[model samples]
Target chain A: MELTRRDALAALAAVGATVGGGVLAGRYDPPRADAASDAGSGSAAEPTLSTDLLDLLDAAAEVVYPSGVDGRRTFVETYVLGRTENQPAYREGLQEAAAQLDAVARDWRGQPYADLDADVRDKLLRDLGVETAEPVADGTITERIRFYVVNDLLFAFYSSPTGGRLVGIENPIGHPGGIESYQRASMSPSSAERSGGTNER
Target chain B: MSADGGSGGSDGGVGDGIDRTPSPSADVCVVGSGPAGALVAHRLADEGANVVVLEAGPRFEFSERTAQQEQHIRPGMEDPWEMGGPRDAYSTEGRHYPLNAARVKGVGGSTLHWQGMVMRLHERDFEMQTRYGVGTDWPIDYDDLRPYYADAERAFGVAGAMDNPYAPPREEPFPLPAFPPSYSDSLFAEACERLEIDMHSVPNARNSEPYDDRAPCLGYGTCKPVCPSGAKYTAESHVAKAEAAGARVIDRVPVQRLEHDDAGETIEAAVYATPDGTEHRQTAGQFVLACGGVENARLLLLSASEQHPDGLANSSGAVGRFFMDHLFAGAGGRLDEPTRQNHVGFNTSETHQFYDDTEPVEGLKLEFLNYAGPSPVIEALGADTWGDELAEQLNESYGTHVAVGGLVEQLPDAENRITLDPDRRDDHGNPVPHVEWSLGERTERAIRRANEIQHAILGELGASIEWTVGPESTGPAYHQMGTTRMGSDPGQSVVDADCRTHDLSNLWVVGSSVFPTGGAMNPTLTIAALSLRTAEALSASLSDP
Candidate 1:
C-alpha cells in the first residue's frame, strides 16, 4: 500500500506525543551556518532558501516523503521558504546540504539530483545511507544531508495540518482547532467510538 | 507644591528640567493600568470621579494582537509587545526569578498573557495564623470581600459551575456557565474517580458565551502567551471601559515616585516621566499605587523623603518585606494509548479537595494539564531516524502522554523579599527592584505532597513515569504576593484593612501586593475583588469630603 501524507503526519503527531510537543522545536538558536561553500556571503540579500536549493528540496522530498503524495513541489517549496526566511544561519546550512546532495548525485548519475528519475534519486539517497548516519553540521556529507535536508523537510511536513491529519491530530500543537474540536473525543478512526463527553468532571 | 498641569489642584507645581505637558489635576490618580488599577479607575469614573491612570508601557493596539499571536507561534520571531528592556530591568539576590518573563509593562499589564483562571479564596485563607498557626491572618476576612468577589465575577464574566463543594460560600452563581472539560480531562477523570479524589470545573475569566460584548473562546490553545481571539478577559477591556466612562488613561508614562506634602501625612502628587524624557507631576486629592508586588514596593521605596526616609509609606518598616509566591509541582508520563495532549492550552478541570485550612501543609490545588506533550514538528525533527523509520517512530509515540500540575501555597517570609538594587539602574536612572527568594521547608513539604498525588494518578493509568518535578526542581508559579501586606496594626504592615496606607492618609496600595497571606489559588481574581472594594472606599471618601 502507498503510504499517504496523512500516515506521515500521524507518525509526526505520535512523535510529538512521545516527546511532549513543541518543547524541542526551535528551542535553540539555529546552528551557525556550516563551514561549507554557502558559509560566507557578504551580499545584502535577505537570508532565505534560494531558488536552486528549493528545486533540490523538491527532488529530495520525492524520495524522503511517503510515496504517492501529490503537490510535492509546491508543499516543499512553500514550507522550506517559510522555514528559512530571515534565518541566515539556517539557510546557509540548507544551501550547504543541497550542494553536498548535488555533488553526490552528479558523481553517481552524471546529472543534478533534481534531473534524475524518482527511483534513481531514491537509490542515490539509499546508496549514501544518510538515513542511518548520525546528523551533524560539520561532520560527514551523509550526516550534514540528514541534519539539514531530510530532517528539515520531515519537520515541515509533519507539523503541517495535512501532516497531522495523516495520523489522528486534526489540529497539531501550536495550531488552533476551534474549542469544539478539543471538547470532542479523539477523531482517530480507531477511537471514534470512545465518547469523550460522557466522563465530564 | 504640586504639579497640577491644569487638571485641577489647589497647589501649582512645575516640571523638573525638561518641558512637560501640563494637564489639569484629577480627583484620583492611579499609578498603574493593570486589572487592579483598571477596575478601580472604571468604578471611580463611573461614579463621577475624575481619574487619571498612568501606565508604564505603550498602548498595544488590539487589532495587532493576532499578529502578536503569530509571533508566539512562529519560531525565532521577535516578541511583538517588547515588554522588557532597559526601562524595565530587575535583578535577583537569591533564587533566579525571570521577572520579565513573569510580567508585562503595558497598559493592559500582565493580564494580556495570563491564563484566565479565577477562583475565590476560602475563608481559611484569611485567618491562617488562627487556624493553621503558621502564616499571619488577613486584616479583613472572606466575608468582607465576598460581595466584591461576586462583583468581580460579574465584571469579568466568569465561566464556572457551583460544583466545587470545597469552595467558600457564595450567594450568587457564576456569571457564565462553565467551560466543558477538555477530552484530556476525561482521561484523568477515570483515575481520579478510582482514587476517590474530587475534580470540578475550573472558574475562568474567559467568556463562555457572548457576555460583556466579548466573543466566546474559539479554542486557540495559546492562552498563556497569546489569545488571538479576545475570548480570554484582559484588563485592556476594563481600561477601554474606563476610557468610555471619561477616565483619562495615560500610557507610556512611568511614575517615578510619590511626592508628599512637607508634613508627609498625605501624598501630594505622583511624579511621572513620559517617553519623551519629560517629567510631569500628577496631583490629585487621592492616589492609588496599583503596580504589581515588585513594582509597588519599588515605587514606595523610591519616594524617600525627610519625613519618611525609609520609603513613602515605610514608617512600619514593612514596605518591601514578606514577599510570597506559590511553588509549582508536576508529574508527567506516557500511556499505552493516545492521550491527545496539547490540543487545548488551558485546563478545564482541577481539584481543591487537598486544600486544607487546618493541616500543617498549606495545601495545594491540582490541574489536569491539557497541553503537556511535545509538539509533532519538534519531535519529528529531534528523532534519530528519517523517512519510513521516523514515520513509524512518530506513529508509535503520538498521543500517549499525560501530565498533572499543581500549585503549593507559600508562607510569607520577610527574608524572601523585594528590595532595591542600588547598583543596577534602569533607563530612567532609577534603582531596580531586587528579589531575594528561597523555598521554605513548609513550601517544600506541600510540593512533596502535591508530587505524591500527581505520581499516584500517573501510576494508576499503568503509565511509565517520564519525569517528576519535586521540591528540588520546583519553581514559582509567578503569582507574586504579600510585600505590602494588609493588617489592622500600623507597625506590622504598610496598608490597613481598607488598603489605605498607614503613614499617608490619602495614599492607597492595591493588587496582590497587599495580600496579607498568599493562597495556593490564582491571585488575579482576589486582586480584582480587593480593587473593587478599595474603589468603593475611595469613591465614598471623595464624595464625603
Candidate 2:
C-alpha cells in the first residue's frame, strides 16, 4: 500500500491523539516527561503564556494540524494549555513568539493584536514565519519559537502509542530478517527521494 | 604466621591451610564476567571444577529495559562514542596510547550491546609477527586453535557458515545455518559481487534458528540497548550455564587487587569490595583475570605490594602494552537499483577481498561488512548534510541503499600501551585504567590505501558516495584488543603460552588482552576460543599434584 506524506501526517495526528489520551489515562509511564520536568525544574522559575497568547497559539497549532477527530484539541491542549503550566522553556518560547506576532500584526495592519480580525491574524502569522520585521540575528525570537513548537509537536506525537504504531516503531521486540530485505531494496534513489531522505533509515 | 591465618593442612603455611571451615572458595576464580570470563567459567564448571566468577556490574535484562529506560542508563546509549575516561586517554604524540577499550561493568559485559557480527581471523593472522615485522606471533597457531573455534561456535549458536568460503576451515558446520540476508545486506552483496569483492554471509553469534532454548532473533531494531530475545549471545548466557554447572557467580563484587606472598611468585588471594562497599577476600587454587584488556592490566598494575614493587606480574615489564583495535571508516551511497531491503537479519553478509597477502605491505587485511538502519540521529545527520534532498532520497531508498565498509587490521606497537591513571578512579574508588595509544605509520598507510581500494570497489558496484570517514583517520572505533599479549618469551610479554603470568604462577589472563594482533575480524569468537583453551588447561593443571 502506497502512503502519501499527507496520509502519514494524518496517521501521525490520529496516533498522537490516541497516545496523548492513553498517556493521560495511565496506560504507560511518561518517562521522558518525568525526565524533562526534572531537568527543567532546577530552581529556575517557569514562565507562562497569557490567556490571550495561549488562545492565539491554539489557533496557530489548529491551522497546522487540521485533521483527525481530536487533532485540534490535542495540539491546543498539549502545547497551549498543558505545556504552559509545566514546561518553562515551552512557555518562554511561546510568549516570545506571541510578542513577535503582535509586533508584526501592529506593523502590517496598523492595529493592536487584540483589535486584529481573524483573516488579518492568519495573514500576519504566515508573513511573520516567512519574513523578520526586526533586524534579527540568526536565531530570532520567531525562529526559536517555531523550532520549539515543531519539536514539541513531534515529541508529543512520537511518544504516543498510536503514533508509534503507525510509524512502525515497535517496542523492545526482535525481528531478525524482516526489515533487512526492505532496507536493501529501499536503498534505491526512489525511496530516498520519496522520504526526502529526511527520516533516518 | 599471621593474625588472619587459618588451621594448617597440607602445606602448614598461613593462607595455604585447608581448614574445611566451610569458607567460601572456588577451585578457579575468573575475574570479569565478560565474554572471556564467561566462557572460561562455563568451560571450567563443565569440566567439574568449582569456578567462582566476579563481575563489577549489575545483571542486565533486556526485557526489563524500555527504550526510554536505556536512554536513562547513560547518554549516547545507542551510539558508541568515547566520552573521556581511562580508556579514552592518548599520549601527546597523537599516536593512540592504548585508548580503544570499551568495557561494560555488567553480567554480560559489553556483549550485552554488541553489533552481533562474528567472524574468525584468517589463517595468516596467526603468523603476522613472522610474515610482517609487526606484532607478535600467537603461541598457538590457527590450526591448533581451529577445534576450539568450532566448539565456541556451537556454544554460542552462530548463524552463517555455508556460503562463506573465505571463512576459516571448519571441522564441523555451524550449529545453525546462515541467517537470511537483510535487504541492506543483499543490496550490498550485489554491489560487492559487481565489484568482484566476493560478498558472502557474515557469521554472527546471534541465532538465526532456535538453538539451546534461546529464541531466534526477533526484529526489535534495538540491538544497541539490549536484545529483547536471548538470540544475541551475551556472557550472561555462559554465566548461567556455568552457574547451572555449579559455578558460583558473585555479582556487584569488584576485585580491587591481587595479594601475593613475600616471594611474590604465587598469588595468595584476590581482595575485592562488595556492592555495599564492604571489603572481602576470596582464596582460590588458581586465578584468571579476564577483566578485559584495560581493567585486567589496570588491576595487575594497581596491585603494587612490597614484594613486587612494579606490580604483581610486571617483572618482565610487559603487563599492559601493544593495545590495538581495527580502524573502521567508510562511505555509503545510493545504488542505481533499489536493493536496500528491510530484511531483519542484522549482519547477514560480509566481504574479505582486502584480506590476505595480496597487499605489498606485509601486515594488513581488510574485511568489508554491511551496516543499515540508520538511527534517528544518523538519519538527522544525513538530512542536515543533504538538506531538502534527504527526505525524498531516504523515502525511496529507506532500506535499499548498500553500506559496505572494511574492518582493517591494526599492527601492534609497544608504544600503544594501556596503563593505570595515577589519579582517576571509578565509582568504587578503584583507580580507572589509563590508555595511551596511537596508530603507527604502517597502520596509517594501510588504512589510506585500503580506503582507496574500498572506494574503487564501491564505485565499480554502481553505488554513489554519501559520506566516508577513514581507515587512517582518528575516530572512536569500538573494537578493542591487545595490551596484555600472550607469548613464549616472558621477557617481552605478560602471559606465557597458556595465558599465565610469568611472575605469578597462579595468575592467568583471558580475553583480547592476550591477543598479540588485532585482526580484521571481530575478537569475541577468538576470545571465546582462547578462554575455552585456558579453562581446559587450568582444569587439567588443577587435577595434577
Candidate 3:
C-alpha cells in the first residue's frame, strides 16, 4: 500500500499500459491500507493504485453495484487494476477519470473524494461533465467512465462461476461445476413465497 | 499405402496450367470439418474409403475451448472460440442474421456453438411445392431420410421420446431417454395443454443418459455459447471418430478452389493454402463440400475457371441462389415470482400446434424459454443506475424472466439470394457472400400473425410481455440455409437427390446449403440426415465402380 515511485513504475511494468509522459510523480492519498492488504486476491498487490484513486474506486464500486446480503468485496479494486494494467483503452480513460475526479473535488468542496459525503459524491458524479443536453443512453465521456469503471466491475463479478451461484444458477456455462436439476421457485401463487419470493413487479 | 490406398487417376487439368505436385490424397476430399463434413468423412473412412477432411480453421481441444468459454462467459464478451476464421471475410455481410456467425470455420464447424436441438425437418418440408404450392420440393422426401435420421440420432446420441403424439411418425424409438423439463418448461407445457396446443419435449443431441462415449447434460444452461460438460454433441465428436477410423484431418488448410480437367465434368484436385502461405494440391476421386450454407456457395463461386466462367457447377446458375433462413419472432414477460430457472434446462419444450405446412403458415414452431432474462436486461441497463435500485429490481426480475418465441417458415425467393459481394473481399481477396435477405409477403404476414399469437398467449398467462421482435421483425436466427438448394430437376437447383452437382460428376454439396425448402425448425438434424444419406450413396457408387 506504500505509494513509492518504485511501486508506481513496477505496477506500470506489470500491466504494461502506456505510462503517460505527463507524470511519474508518486502520490500517497491512501485509503484503509490494512483492509486492502487483508483482501484475499493476490492480484490486488501487483497494481499501483494511489490511495486517492483506490478510495475513489471503492466509493465508485459501492455506488455502481450496491451490496446485497452477501455484500460487495473489493471487486472494483481488482477490476480497476486488471483493466488499467492489462487493457490500454481502459487505462487511458480511467487515468483521465482520476484527473477529472480530482478537478471536480477541488472546485465544489475542497476535500478528497473519500472525505466527501455520499450524497455529495453522488451529486458530483450525477453532474459530471456530460456531452448532450438531453439524456444519453450511450456515447458520452461521462458514460465512458461508467462503462470503463463500473461495468467492468459488474462483469468481473457476474461472469465468474461464483457470481452465478450467488443468484441460484448452480452453474453458469463456463463453470466446470455441473448442475443436475433446476432449483427454481414454483411459478404458482400458492407456492410463490417458498423462499421469501414475492411478485416480481 | 494410406488406409484408403487406391490408384486414383487424375481426372482433369493435369497438363494445362496451375502447376503443383498432386499429393496422393484420400479417395474422397471433404472440405470443412463441421457436422456434415465430419459425418460423411467418418462414415466413408469406416467404410474403408480414404477420406481427408480439410478444416478452414484450427482444431480446438476441449480444454482450450473450455478456457476460451470461461473468459467469454463473462458479460459483454464474445468468445473468440465461437468466431469464424480468415477464409470468411467474403462471407460476413449478414444484414439480417448475426454478423459474427457468418460461418464458424473451425474443425467442429458451427456445431461448436449450437444449442444441440436435433429435430427433423417436417415431412411436408420436403414437399413444399407439392403440399403448399410454394417453393420447390426436395428431390427426396422424409421417407428416404427416415432411416438416415435414425442412424444420425444414434451417431449424435440424440435423446427424446419416440412416441410423441404431436411429432411426425418415426420408424424407431429414440436412442436415449428425454431429459426432464425444468419448472419453467413444465409451466409452459401446462399452459399449452390448457390452450389445447400440442407442446412436446424437443429432441436433443445432448445426452439425457450417457449413450455415446460423451457424458450426459449436467444442466449448465449455456448450450449455445459453450457446453462445459461436453454433454452437447459438437462436430469435434464426429471429427474424432473420422480420425480414429483412419480419415486424415488437415486443419488450418483452406481449400482455395477445385481444379477440373479439360472436359470440365469432374473434379481433379483440391488446391489449398496453409497458414504460412504454403500451397498444396490434394488429388481425389470425389470432392464433398460441407462448408455450411454461405461458404459452400461462395467456394463454388470462387472456383470460376477458364472452362466454367459462370463458376463451377453453375450450369443452372443456381449455386448461390435461393438463399433461405427461418424467420423467428415472439415476445417474453415476467411471471409473478422468480422464474429465472428457465435457463436451468436445455431447449426443453416446443409447440407444434401452429404448424400447418400450407401456403399461409407452414412454419410456425413456438419455443418456451427456460432461463433468467435479466442477464441481457441488466447488461442493457449498464452500470449506471444499475447499482442500488436497479440491482434490487434485477434480483427480483432475473428470477422471474419468462419468454416465448418461435420460428416462422420462409419460402424460397430468387431475389432473396446469396451473391458475391462486389464491394467487400476476404483476406484471400475472394469475394464474400452478399446476402439479399429481403422477406416476402408470406414471411411478413407470418411475423405479424406470430406477434399477435405471442401477445395473446402471454396475455392469457397473465404475465407482462418484456421482449419481442425477431427474424422478419428484427434479426435472423443465423440458421442460414438453401444457398445451394437441391431438387430433382437440374435446371432449378444446384444439386441433385444425392446432393451431387449437375454440371460436375464427382462434386457433391452437403449441409443446409442443399436444403430445397427449410421447415420452421432447427436444420442441424436434417443436415446430418442428408449428409449420412449422401455418404451411403457415395460409398455405394465408389464400391460399384
Candidate 4:
C-alpha cells in the first residue's frame, strides 16, 4: 500500500510520542510550582491549563502547522499540557499568550479564537503582525503570541519525529538514527550533480 | 606529617606512617579516573597488580544517557552532568578561562563529553627548542613515545587511515579503518582542492566497526556532550575493565591532599573525603597524580609541607607554573545549497598541512566541522514567521550553513598559571584553584593566520561569511597542558623524563600536565601514550623487591 503523508505523520508521531514519553518517564523532573500561598503548605499540586486556554492553543496549532499534517490538535494538546508541568514562569507565559490570543479574537471577530473559522483565525494572527514581530515576554500582544504561541507550537512539532520527517530531516538533532543514513551525501540537486561528476563514487 | 597540616582538613583517619596501614592497601593508588589515571590503573590491574582508583565525582550511568541527551538538546535545561557547584568552584583571572566548562569530574572524566579527535604530535613538537629556538625541548622525543603511541591506538581502538601526509611517522596501521569524510566535509573538500590544501581522515577514538567489544557509531549525533551509544571511547570503559581485573574503583571521593613522609621523599597516603564529610587515607607503595592539568597542579600545591614548603615536589618551584592551552579560530557562513550539517556530530576529516609551517608561528591544524548549522527544532523556534512561511524558512536554513575551524598552539608562559585562591574555599575547606591566563602575542598571530586560511577556503566555496573568530574573540579549545612541566633539570620543572616528580622518589605525575610544550593536536592521545608508559614503569618498579 502506498503511504500517504497523513499516514506517515500519524505513524511517526506515535513512534515519537512513545520514545519521548518512555525515555523521559521517571527522570523528567521539571521545576516545582512556586505558589506563594502554597510555599510553606507543602502542596504537590502541579500547575495546569484551563479548558478554554487549551482549546485556544489547540486551534492555534492547526493554523500554525503545515496544511498536509494531521493530528495537530492532539499533538498541540499534549505539548501544551506538558508545558504546564514546566517552570511556573513558563506555564504562566503559555496561559497569558493564549489569553491574549482569545482577547484579540473577541475584539476583532466578536467571538473566542477557538470558535472562529480556521481561515479567519489565520488572518487574525497575520493582521496582528505576529509573523514579523520579534518575540518578547511582557511585550506587545504580537510579540507574546510570536514567542509563547507560534514558536512554542513550532518547537513542539519540529522537534518531534513526525514534523522532522515532514521537512525531509529523517532524524533531527538529538534524535537517534543509524550511521547508514549519514554515511553518504543527501540527494539534493547540487550534491547529486557533484557526486556524479567529480567526487569519488 | 599529619593529614591536617597545611592540607586544610580536620576530619581524618589512617594517617600514621606508611608501614602501619595494612587494611585497605594497594600496590598502587591512582587519583582521578580520567584518561590518564584510568589507563594507568587498568594496565596495572591487567598485569596482576592491586590498584585503587579514586574519582572526585559520581559515575554517570549509561542507562541515563538518553535522558541526558534530551536535557542537552532542549533549550533552558540545566547541565545534564551537573558539573558545577560549591564543590567544583574555581575562579579565573585574566582571559576568563571557563574551567568547569572545559572539564568534568567522574569515572570517565572529561572524555564523557569529548569529541574523540585523537592526533599524534609531530616530531618537531618534541624538539620545539632545537627547531625554532622558542620553547624548551621535551626531555623525551617522539621516538620515545612512538611505540607507546601505537600501543595507545590499539588500547583505545582508534579508527584511522594512513592518509595524513603531515602526520607523525608510524610503524603500524590504525586498529580500525577510518570513518569516511562526512557529507558536509565533501563540500569543504572540493574547496580545499582548489586552494591546494590537503585534507585527510582524522583519527578518532570512536568505534568504526565495533572494535574492543563496543558498538559502532549509530549516528546519534550527540558525540560531543553525550554519546548514547558506546561507540565513543570514554575512559570509563577502561575503568570497568580495571574493576573486572581486581582493581577497586571508588567514586564520589575527592582527594583533599597527599601526605608525605618526614623527608618528603615519597607520598605515603592520599587523604580523600567521602559524602558524609569524613576524610580517609589510602596508602600504597606508589602514587600517581593523574587529575588532569589543572587539578594535578592544585593538588600538589595543596599538599605543601614543612620539608617541601612551596609544595610537595616543589624544590624546583615549578609545580603550577608554565601553564598552556590551545585556542581556536574559525569562520563560517551560509552556502548556496544544502551542506547537510548536524547530520553527524564528530568530525571525520581535517588538514594538518600548516601544522609545521613556521611562517604562522608553528603549529596550526584545521578541521572541517560537521555539526555547524542549526538543527530543525532550533530553526523552527528561531524563525520569525508562522505557518507555511515558517516551514519554508526551516527548509532553507536547516542545512545551508557550513564552517571551518582550526586549533592554534599557545606557548607556555610562566605568568599564565594556576594558583591557590586565598578567599574561596571548597567543601573540604581547601583553597580553590585560581587560574591566571592570557593569550600571548604569538598565539594571537597564529589565530589570525588561521582565520585568513579559513576565509580563503570559505571564499572559494562561494559562501557568504556570517561570523569570524579573531584573536580577541577566540577562546580556549579546552586541551589543558603544561601546568606541571617535565624537564631533566631539578630547578626548572616539576616532573622528570619518566614523569616522576623531581623532589619525590615514589611520586609520579602523568597526563598533559607534564608536557614541556603542547602542539596544536588534540592532547588526549599523548596523555594516553604517557599513561601507558607510566603504567609499565609502575608495574616494573612494583615487581622489584
In terms of TM-score, the best-performing candidate is 4
After superposing candidate 1 on the true structure, give the runs of residues whose Cα lies further than 4 Å from its correct spot.
A1-68, A72-160, A188-201, B1-22, B378-393
**Which candidate number would show the highest lDDT if scored against the true structure?**
4
lDDT of 4 by residue, B1-545 (tens): 43322242332232422122222768899999999999999999999988988888878898777557755654434687788899999998999999998998998999998889998999999989888988899999999999999999998999999999998889999999999887788888888999999999999999999888799987777888888778999998999989899988877779999999877788899988765566678898899999988999999999998887888888887888888888999999998777777766888889999999989656999998987877877666655566777777777767788899989999888998999999999988999999999988889999999999999999999999999998999999898889889999988999888898888888889999999999899999999998899888888888992
Per-residue lDDT for A76-189 in model 4, tens only?
555555444434587678676776777677768877788899899899998999877766766777888887888767756765555665565655665555565554666333
Worst 10 residues of 3 chain B by lDDT: B2-11
Better of 2 and 4 by TM-score: 4
DockQ of candidate 3, scored on C-alphas against the true complex (2 decimals)? 0.16
What is each model's TM-score for chain A?
0.64, 0.42, 0.49, 0.65
Chain B superposition TM-score per model = 0.94, 0.86, 0.91, 0.95
State which candidate, 1 or 3, has the greater lDDT: 1
Docking class of 4: acceptable
CA shift of A34, model 2, Å: 23
> What local lDDT score does residue B446 receive in model 3, on the 0 to 100 scale?
83
Candidate 3 vs candidate 4: which has greater TM-score?
4
C-alpha local distance difference test of each model: 0.78, 0.60, 0.68, 0.80
Ranking by TM-score: 4, 1, 3, 2
Lowest lDDT sum, 10 consecutive residues, model 2 chain A, at A169-178
Q: Per-residue alpha-carbon lDDT of model 2 for A37-123, expressed as tens digits? A: 566742223322222554555454433331232444443444334434433554565565555555555557866554666456546
Expressed as tens digits, the lDDT of each residue in B1-545 for candidate 1 is: 12334432221122233223434768999989889999999999998899989888777887666557645554334675786789989999777888888878888888988998999998889998998677899989999999999999998899999999899999989999998998888888998999999889999989889888898876656688777668899999999999899988877778998999989898988888775555688889999999898999999999999999899888788988988888899999888777777666788899999887345459689998887777565566556555566666666677777899998899988898888998999888999999999887878888888998899988886778999989999888888888898999998999998899999999999999999888899999999999999999998899886
- Candidate 1 lDDT tens digits, A72-186: 7656654555455445686777787777787677667877787889889877886898756666766777878877787667755765556665555666654445567666676
What's the C-alpha lDDT at position B531 in model 1? 96
Indicate which candidate wins on DockQ: 4
